[model samples]
Structure formats: structure tokens, C-alpha cells
Target: MRYEVWAPSASQVTLHADGRAYPMRREDGGWWRRAAPGTDGTRYGFALDDGPALPDPRARRLPDGPDGLAAVLDPTLSVWRHDWPGRPLPGAVLYELHVGTFTRTGTFEAAAEHLPHLAQLGVTHIELMPVCPFPGTHGWGYDGVAPWAVHEPYGGPGGLVRFVDAAHALGLGVVLDVVHNHLGPSGNHLPAFGPYFTDRHHTPWGAAVNLGEPEVRAYFTNSALAWLRDYRLDGLRLDAIHALTPRAPFLPELSSAVDELSQSLSRPLFLIAESDLNDPLTTTPRSSGGHGLHAQWNDDFHHALHTALTGESQGYYADFAADPAQALAKILRGGFFHDGTYSSFRNRPHGHPLNPSTTPPYRLLAYTQTHDQIGNRAQGDRLSAHLSPGLLACAAALTLCSPFTPMLFMGEEWGARTPWQYFTDHPDPALAEAVRTGRRREFAAHGWPSDAIPDPQSPETRLRSCLDWDEPKREPHARLLAWYRRLIALRRATPALTDPDWSYTALSTDDRTVHFRRGPVHLAVNLSPQPAALALGGTAAIVAAWSPVAPPDGAGVLHLPPETAAVLLAT
Candidate 1:
């Protein structure tokens, strides 16, 4: 196959083949090279006579820096044995993990050790934080430099293949989080070859990846399929897709392309959209004037649940904490916040009510704690520090017992003590300093003291974020683990919990207790510190409790102790 690098501004381009550097022809206003016999592994780098040497635009397997010689890699050689397909639907439990912090090794091989514990949690899917190669070893994978290649430190492409194979062997499905918006500044060498990004659109990170031009559009779809076909990824969690808006027509062609590819693949592929638009169209079918996604992260639910549980009102949390009982009730039953009401955040009326009767409930992924809520904090402290034990149990129940696909962040199950701090190991000194300054500026808007913000580039930041394997084996941590294990067991036992019909469930809450009704199962949660009498929607048979004490067994008033939760079946 012939290789081409786009350095349109270069006066002369040289393709270093083997030991010889041969000047390439400027065909069609770009550099071109044809491989000779036995040239599959021939390493080549582009020498722009005017500018410094840059990496190949389509370098799939980069063992070295961007300036290192790029070679043509055959993707067919990698033997994938992930024969089993992913989860069927709401039947699956998901665990969201950060590649860098999952283990101290921070490589794919090191992460393999925890796959067994995940299986014990009855987890069916493992959602890996972005694997796209970034500058350094530490990051949430949001700032990816190479959208296609796996990060080298995290075992690169080969280690990833082994990780996936191992996960499937343990009967777990793997979903990859991919950032299609902006590239991290450090190791990004794409612009040196082609106009992969457009000056028209810009996201919070930087200019959005170009999906307008024909070749650019093709590139993204190809990348999407490669994960499924080559890496054996079951699903693609589309990150910040709301930031992607097409030029004039306003038609979201990206969604259409994904759907088309999913159709052609003929496999059980899933697409989860992570959008805060609160627009049901994000998960709605394309025929219904929506972006045909399988399911999307429900931020409104998180906001309502977080504010209600923790009561920390700053920035976006301010608009939500006002009437959290009502906000959460709507999300619990309807799946969105605005539900045709006005939103103070956007200062406008927004969101259509989700048709719970017609719409499957699992389409919404609910979580009280996620990386955003934790890492975005002045200190990346988990909610374990903020809420009481009862409240923590309440939040986990709210997610797992609700009519949605529940997701648990890493270290959330046992109430991990270590905070998931934001850290970067960028090679570029200027970019590293810029990140620190940017973080300080962002937190200041939320009333956080600028000087108190931890440096995003510091070693202490990443070190603090690493999980302590011993923590789960001890104390209130052990108690927290037991609570989660029992809750997950109960959630799996009760078919009503995962039922798709939202209409079958009813919820009513006061300031002290939150009530959830699924068919005959009633979950009453006490958020207060003192014992209180709670009126049951109906008389219930006690099935489960978060604490050691059993709830009263009767068809009358149920009494609960401080920071307690109970699950019951109507007698």
C-alpha cells in the first residue's frame, strides 16, 4: 500500500525509507510514498524542508515519539478471541474505571487483576475510561492526543487486546470511552499532516475534530468500527457529543454514520451518548427526530440526586438543589429534568418529558457519583466524606433500584477513601503550566480559593488518586462493601427493579425519607439522623435492609432508625 502525508505548506518533503531518505513527489498537492516489496515494516518519517520533522497523520502503532519513523501496521495480524457478545440490556451492571488509576501499574496487564472482583459484583460490563493515547501516563483520558491508538504506557494496542480477551474470558463485556472532540496539546501530531480539526467549531478543550469534510467524516466512522471489529469493543460511549454540531444543515450526520455502521456490523453493538442537553432526542431513534443512541448518561438525574443527597450548591448545583425532591421524582419516573419546564442554568425553558410508557427505562444510565462530580471538585474527594453512611446507601439504592442502567465509578462500591484527583503528565512544559493556570481559573468561579487548588501537573495529585487495595479489606470500608454487596444481590434478585416499565413504579418523598415503589417492592430511605415514622404507600413485607436492624413486619406505619434504608414487598 502507498502512504501519503499532507504537508501542503512544505517546499520539499522527504520520506525516509529504510536507511535512505528519498524525496517524495508532491502529487495532488500532498506527499506520497509506495511501499516496495518486503516494506510492511519499513519505518518512515516525514522531513518537511521548511519545518521540523513530524509524525505520520495515520500512525496506528507508534512505539516511539511522533517524530519517530511511522510504519504500515497490518491490523489483521492481531488475533482476537472475544467470541461472546456483550450484555443484552438492563440485565447488565456496569462499572466505570479509569485506566490510569485502576491499578498502580496503570497498564492493561496490571488492570487485569481486578477483573475477578468485578465479576463477583455481578458486573457484566467494564466501561474503560478513554484508551486513546495521550501525552503521559496519568489522565482521565479526556485529553487524548491520538484518537485511534491505545496509550503506550497503558500497554499500547497489544496489551489492550490481551485485557479485552481476559475480560471476555471472565464473562465480562468491555465498553471503550472515546473522545471525538478535541485533542490534548502535548503529543498531538495530526495537524502537521492534515486539517483534521476545523476553525469553525470549538469545545471547552479546543477546536472540535472535523466531521464535515468527506475524508474527515470517513476517518471517524472508520475509527469507530475499528474498535468493534478489531478491538472487540461491545459499545462506544460517545463523549460530549452535544459539543459536536454540523455546519449549516444542522443535521447530525455523525449519528447517522454510527447507526449505519452498527447495522452493517450485524453484532450486538451499543451506543451510549454522554450529553447534558437533557434532550430525549439524544437517545431517541433517528426516525423520531433524535440521535439514534442506545442509552445516554443522565446528568440531570445525577444533578438532582447529588444536590439532594449532599446539598452542596455551587455553580450548576445551585439551580438544582432548590426543589430536589421534585427534581429527583421526575427523573425517577420520567427520565429528565426540564420536562418542558424552564431551566435557570440556561436561563430558558428546555427539555421534553420522556415518554416513560413508550420509552424503555434502561435507556437512562443513572449515577449519584461519577468522575465529573468527584474530579471537578476543589479536592477530588468522593461522596464518602460528604454523606452519612445511610445517605451513601440511599444514593446507591437510588441508582441500582431505579428503572435505569446503574453505573458505579471506580472505588465507589466500597466507598473508596482516595479522591479521584485531576492530574496530567504532559511532555510539553508550556502546556503543563497552562493546564494548572486553567484549573485554578475554573475553580475560582465556583467560589473556591484559587491558591487552595491542587496543581493538576503535580505528582502528588496522581499519587493521591491511586486506589489503596488494603482500604477495601478494612473498617467502615468493610462495612460499606458489605452494604453494596447485599444491595447488589437484592437488586439482582428482584426482577421488578430492572423492569422496563416506569409506569409500574411510584415514588413519593418528604425531606426526611425518599420512597420508591416498583410493582410490589417498596424502598424507603431515611436521610435524617433520628428515628422517625414513615407512611407506607402500601403495607409491605420486609425483604432487605441496609443495616443490622430489621424494619417492622406489618401492613401499617413503618419505623426507621437514623441513617437507615429498607426494601419491602407489598403484602
Candidate 2:
């Protein structure tokens, strides 16, 4: 087999495979290559001059870990069972799943067993969190070091292939969450090979990825494409594109490449970015001087809904707490609340206004909770921990019924009580201590007792985060799960719920109630602690409700219980 690596800074390079070293000849563009006697499953690494062998930056399989030797994986060896016709983003209900805590086994094979549950839950796509190899056996995966390799603990590349094949067999599309912003602090050796990161810009993790360099840019773009192509993935959720420097060429360039590949594959593949910039340009066309991504996570929507449901106004939640009904109304009508408005959290004007008339509502995803919202909390408590089942159903109704694409974090359908906490298994003791201390310090600054913060390095933290599957079989949880199913079925049945045009969406807010309408469908939500009356524009039939909601009277007034939501079909 041929061995290749990009070591622009190295004077001499050697390929170590099967306990033998072969000198690699330098080629153009700072690449080194040599043919080695190896085949599938061959363990190999590259040595720079007198330095130790380092894993390939583009390694396909790291069997042991990120620091371990890279193993060759022949993509042709695995056979797919389904010839999927492809699922698009227009009407997709995305479910964000973390492989580590998704199942007790924390492996792709085990997670695949639960696909039937998601399929029956009416979600169209399963958005798997990053499976990239990090320093430990388990993590949130944002700290991944090997961008191209799958975590060995989570069934590696082969297991992912099998899982995707299984999902395809069930007519479900799989999208992966990928972190390209910054490599983890530990077990990262990219700097030893070449200048993969530049000091011109800095992110929360320090030096930004060097997108100015041609090869470095290609490195990221190619990695994304390879996942979509090789693994037959339907799409990717790009993590933190706002952190990437020179976003113009890099994002547009990636979108162009992905578009070309999608055409070649004759599939509906796409890129969804997690950006806080609130810039519509993130989803604009390249010809129109925009990045041209398919969709992005709408944290504004989550924040508004969270504050309205829980009335928690800490941190960024403060921006939406003053009048959550108005904030939610703005998001339902337009797309963002901080559209060039002052943000108390950032202490500055943040976000540009989105042209709702021009942009499709489906380009923005609506969710009540996500990994960051749940895991970053002091106790990693989910909404179920604080709110009653009626309110949980209300959140589900608003999100799944909104015109924007809807996404559900894992175990949310059944109101899973497991707290998705910040847990890591870094082998380095100092790094582990730093992570544990930092987590406690962050919550401590928020007035939480240091002892109240869970130890991130503890295995119990991860175990506590795992979904208790039995919850779905019990009371309130079972009822909430039924509500989720009914809401999704209603959305699937109603065209207005999945309508792409933002012009069709409108909302009106009262003191503690909101009446939202998209086309002929109306959603009335009462966030107050007491029962309230909401007036629909016209007489409507009650289609779905979290609590008992009477049909509108002659004046089109809907009586909704507090902390509940009801869907109405306008006549």
C-alpha cells in the first residue's frame, strides 16, 4: 500500500509499518510518499527525522486511541444493505444523539438497536454527535484531536458504517456533528508535522485553524467531504463556524465542494453550522456573497423557549428573560431576537437581522434543548428536572409545530431524567485535573457551591448521564413520549407546520400567552402560572393540546391552562 503524509516543516520523513521503517521521498506541495508492504488493517505511523512515530493527521482508524498507531481501513470491505433515496432538510426532524451516553454500551452497534424507537418517534434524521477520536474512551467529542478518525470506543469506522447502514435500512438519514474549530489540548500532534494552526487569530481555545494556507484549508474541506462520501452520511452539523477565521472562502469553498459532491453522488447532502453570529449570510448563496450552508442551529429560539418555560434568567438566558413571550414571538415571526440589538451577555450589539421574506424558515432549526444547554449546566439538569410534564409537552408542541425545522436532544421524547453532564476521561492526570477544576470554577463563579459541581473526571458522571430507557415505560414520561409522537404526527400531517416560506409565519403575544399562526394552523401557548385565555384570529378546532384546551368561542378565544400549549386548525 502507498503511505503518504504532509510534513512541510520536516527535513526527513520515514514510514514505520509492521515493525519496519522505509524512508519517504519528498514530493511537491510539501508532501512525502512511499510504497510500503501493507494491506487492510495494517498499523502504521510516520516518523519525522529522529522524532518518534506520529499518527497520521488524516488517519482513517485509530484502534487504540488518538495517540496510537493508525490502521488502514479499506472502505470497499463493508457492504451497505440499503440503497437510500436520500432525505432532505426541508421537512427533516433532527434528533441530536450522543453516542457515548445514548446507550448503556456506548457503541455504534448498541445505539443501532434503538433506531426503531427513533423511527417510530417520527424523527426523520439522527444527528450523531462527533465520533471523532479524542484523548479518552468517552467525551462530548468537541475536544476531538483526530478529525478524520472515529473513536475506537464507539465502534470506530466499521461500526459507524454498520450503524449508518442500519439507519438507512430504516429509511432514516444520519448526520454527524463535526468539530473543526480547535483541536483538543491533549494528544494533538498536528503542530509537529506542519503549521496547521495560525496565530493571526485566536478563539476560546487559542490559535485558530490556519484557513489562509491552501493545504490547511483543503485538509478540513476534504475531511468533511470524505465523511459524507465514504460513510454515506446524509449531512454534517459543522460545529462553531464562527470560530473559523476567513469564514468567507473557507465556508463558501466547503459548501461549493459539498454541493459538487452531492451532485456527483446524486444525494441530498448538506452542511448545518452552529453559529451564534445570527447572520443570514451563513445560509445565503455563494453567488449572493454568502457562505451558502443549508441550515444552522437557532440558539435564540432555544433561549427564548427556555426562559419562557423555566423562567431562568442566568447567563445568556438573561437576554430573553425580560419578556420571553415577545422574544419567542420575534423568533417565530422572523428568525432571531438579537437582530442587531444590544446583548447584555456580550455587553454589545450582536447579530444581524435576517430577511424573513427572503430566507426560508427551515434554514433555522428550532429546539428546546441541546447538548450544550444540558451538559454545560452545573448539574447537567434537563428541562424535565425543573418543569412538569405539561410544560415539557408545551415545549415539544412549540418546537415541533414551528415552521422552522425541529431538532430534539436524545431522550427528550420521553422526558428522560438523566442529566447530560460534562464528563471526560483524559488519560493525562494534569489535564484531567484542569478540566475538573475549571468546571467547578465556572459554576462556582455563578454562585454555585464548588462541591455541588460534578467531577468531570468521574465515571459516575458519565453513568448518571446515560438515558434510563425504562422511563419511557412509566407515568409522566410515557405520557410525554405520547405527546411528542402526537405532535410529530400532527406536523407531518399538516403542510403548514413544515412550510419553508417564512412569509407564511406570524405571531402575536399578550402578557404571558402567545398565539402563533403559519398558514392555516395556529399554536396557542400559555406560559403564565395561571390559566389564561388566548384569542385566535378565527374559530379553530382543537387538534392537539398538552392540557385540556376548549375550542375557541364565537369571539375566537381559546382557554388554555397555565404552562400548556394547544394546536388549532383555523377554519
Candidate 3:
């Protein structure tokens, strides 16, 4: 076996393997390495200048958590049962889930048991929220320290292999949500090794990654490739790329490296980014002077639909509250409601315009709920707890019928009532207290009561966030699940609904309603408090509806009840 790590700041480095210390030889570019035959479960850590041993930055498995020794296990040794020829971005329905809260066991093997349920829900892709190892135990996963190690509490590296293999067997592709902006405040050992982070730019979490440094860039790029090659992951969702400051060459460079790996693997791979910039160039090809990513999460769509349904008008929601119908219509027509527009919330101009004719609709991933949108709230209430059943169905109809690709938060399909609150298990008392205080302060700014915020260190907080799997088999939950299944089935059956060509899509809006046409399918949603009417020419049939009345006669008019959405197929 061979062991290596990049630790430029250290003059002497040693490998601690199974209670034995061996001096390591320093190699070029701040790397230290040693080769020796070892068994599969060999435990090791690197010691610098006779100090405490630290886990490997690229450790594949941390059986004892982040602060303990890294275990040696080859990914190729895992047995795979299927040869999945990955799915494409267009017309794909993505389901996002967190392993810890996704199942009662909160392990990868247990999560794999639910893959068939997602497949039955008509999900083509499964997007797992960060599985990288963090401190203590459970977390939201964005605060991960070891970028390459799987969370041990959730079954580590072998468990991930099993999960991916099971997903492939079910005809579902897996997209991992990876955080590269900054490491968590506690248990992060990257700084002690070399210049992995820089003070040149600061993000909301902390100092930005040293992306401008060649070695730092190489480290991340290699990690990205390992997910595709070693773990057999189909794609990656880059978390909050907007926070990656000095993004000039790094974004493009990372995209290029992934594209190369995708070609080499002979499998379709995608790179989706969670970007707040609303810049179309994030998905534009590198040859055209852009980042060359496949798609990006469209928060504009979420905000528009969220405000329209809940009528909440705080913070960024204030922008969409004034006219949600207009906001929805703008995104449906041009892919961004705030494109080059004044944002009163930010007190400045935000975003740039996108050409509907040139831009592909699949480049944008639309959703009504996400981890940040729900979990970041003071009470962490899901839309299911707030919105009416009809309104929830209405939101689903619009999301599935939209031209862009669609993603659903873990329990959104069945309207699970569990709140995905921000929970952490930091072992350090000071760090844990700071997290609790910071969470309360942040929500207090949004006018939420500080007393309502859950304690981050409490085990009950983590347990409360787990999904109620039995909910989907009963009452309104069953009905909502049926509605989602029907909408996804319609999306797959209707060619017009899956078309990515934005030029083929059109939109119109009034004070209480919004209507759009994608190919031969027309969608009309009424956001008013009372029944509304819209004109539709020619012969059309109601393909799907939420509290919809009978289709109007040849008089070319349709009436919809309050908060209703309808999809019609034109003959």
C-alpha cells in the first residue's frame, strides 16, 4: 500500500500505521509519501514534527469520525451488480434527500431500501445532500471537514458504494451535493497542512478556499474525479458557487476537468451549481467563454412559487411579494425574474439578462422547496404544514409542467410534516454554543422569535428532523403522493412538457393568474383568493388539474377555482 499527503508547512512528516511510526520521505510540491504492504482495514494518520497525528485530507473512510484515524479501504474492492449508462439532464426529475433524516436507521443501507419508492415516484435522479464527514455525529453536511471521507455515522465509504450500486440497479442516477466554499469552523485540519484557504476573499462561513493556488485547485479537482471514477456517481451539485470569490479561472478550470473525466469514463456526467448570481454564464459552455456547467438551481422559481402560495413577505421574499404572478411569469418566459433588475432586498441591481432563444431551459433546475429555503427558517416548517392541499398540488403542477428541469426536496412529494431544522453535533462546547447563538441571531433578523429556535447541540433536534415514512400511506399524504406520481407520469408522457428549447415556450400574466405554453401543452395557474377565468382558443383537454372545473366550451374560456392550476393539451 502507498500513502501520501501534501503538507508543505511541515519540515518532517511521519506515518502512524496501526501503533507503528515510520518516517516518510518528502516529495516534490509539498507532498510526503511512503509505500508498504498492508491489510484492507489498516488504520493510519499523519504526524507532523512529532506532534499529534491528523486524519488524511483525502481520507476515504473515518470509522471513528473526523478527529480519529483514517482507515484504508480500496473502492474497487466493492462488488457492483449493475452497469448503469447514466441519464441526461433534459426532462430529468431530481429528488434531493439527506441520508441521516431520510430513513429511520439514518444509514446508507437503509436509505438504499427507499430507492425503489423514489423510482416509483417517477424520479430519474437522486440528489444526496453532502455525505462528507463532519464533526461529532449528525449535521446538515455543508460544514464537512474531510472532503473525500463519507460520514461514518451514515456507514462510511462502503455504505456509499452500496447506496450508489442500489440506485443504479433501480435505474436512478445519483448526484452528490459537495461544498467547496469553506470548511466548518471546528475539527478542520486543512489549514495546518498548507495554504488550503486564503484571506484574499471571505465568504459567509469563513475565508474562501485557495482556488487561485494551483495545488489547491488540483486537490479539489482530483476529489471531484474520485466521486465519478471511484464511487460511480453520475453528477455533482456544487454547493453555493457564488461564494467562490475570485472565480474567474477556477470555475472554468473545474468544469473543464470534470468534462474531461466524463469523456474518459464513457458515461454521461453533469455538474450543477447552486449559484445566487442568476448568471446564465454559469451553465454556458467553456468554448463560448463561460463556465461550461450543465445546470444551476433557480432560486427565483422557488421564491416566486413560495410567496405566491404562502403570502410571506420577509427578507428576499419581499421582492416577489409585490407581484408573484409577474415574478412567476418572468421566470417562465426568461429563466430569471430578477435579471438585470433592481432588488430592493439587496439595495442594488442584481443578475444579468438571458436570451430565451439561445439559452436551454434545462440549464435551470426549478423547485418549490430546498434545505436552505426550509431548514434555515426559524421553525423549519415545510410548505405542507402551511399551505392548503390544493395549493400544494398547484405548486407541484407548475413545477413539473415548467420548461426547466425539476427537483423535489426529500419529503415534498408526500408532503411530509417533519421539519428539517439546522442541527449539528459539534463536540467542542464553545463551538457548539456559538452555533446555537448564531442560529437564533440569524432568524431574529427575519422577525422570528429567538425562543422558537431549536438548540443545535440537542439530540432531540436531530431526531425531530427525520422523515415520517408511514405518513405517505395515509389520508391527505397518500393523495398528495398520488398527485406527484400523476404529474411526473404526465411529464414523461408529454413530449411538449420536456422540451428544453426556451424559444418554444411562452408566458402571460395578470394580477391573479399566470399562463404559459410549452410546445402543445398550456398551463394556467390562478393565484387569486377567488375563482378566475382565462381565454384559451381552439380545442383542448384537461390533462391534469388542482381543484379545476370542467373545460369550457368552444366559447374559448376556462374557469379555475381559487389557488388552482391546470394543464391542458391542445388538439
Which of the numbered candidates is closest to the native, going by highest lDDT? 2
Please rank every candidate by TM-score, starting with the best. Answer: 2, 3, 1
User: Candidate 2 lDDT, tens digit per residue, 377-455?
Assistant: 8999999998888788888988998889999999999999889999999999999999989888888899999999999
The estimated TM-scores of all candidates read 0.92, 0.98, 0.97
Per-residue C-alpha lDDT of model 3 across residues 1-571, encoded as one tens digit per residue:
8899999989999999988888999999899999865667789999998889898888888888888888898766888889978887888999999999997689999998889999999989999999999888788898898888899889988889999999999899999999888888777889888999999889888789989888888888888888888889989999999998777787888889888888988888889999999998998888887898889999999999888888889889999999888898888878999898999999999999885645688889999999999898877789988888788888998899888899999999989899988899998998989999998998888777888899888998889999999999997899889989999999999988887676544577887787877777888888777998888765678988877478967786888888888889877
- Using alpha carbons, what is the TM-score of model 2? 0.98
Global lDDT of each candidate: 0.77, 0.91, 0.88
Where model 3 places Cα greater than 4 Å from the true spot, the runs are 504-506
lDDT of 1 at 524: 79
What is model 3's C-alpha RMSD? 1.4
Number of clashes in model 2? Answer: 0
Task: Write model 1 residue lDDT over 461-566, tens digit each, in one string.
Answer: 8888988888888977777777777778888888988888877456788776778788888887777788767777556778777775455546567888878888
- Cα lDDT of candidate 3 equals 0.88
Model 1 misplaced stretches (Cα beyond 4 Å): 1-14, 17-33, 37-42, 46-53, 79-82, 247-266, 549-553
What global local distance difference test value does model 2 have? 0.91
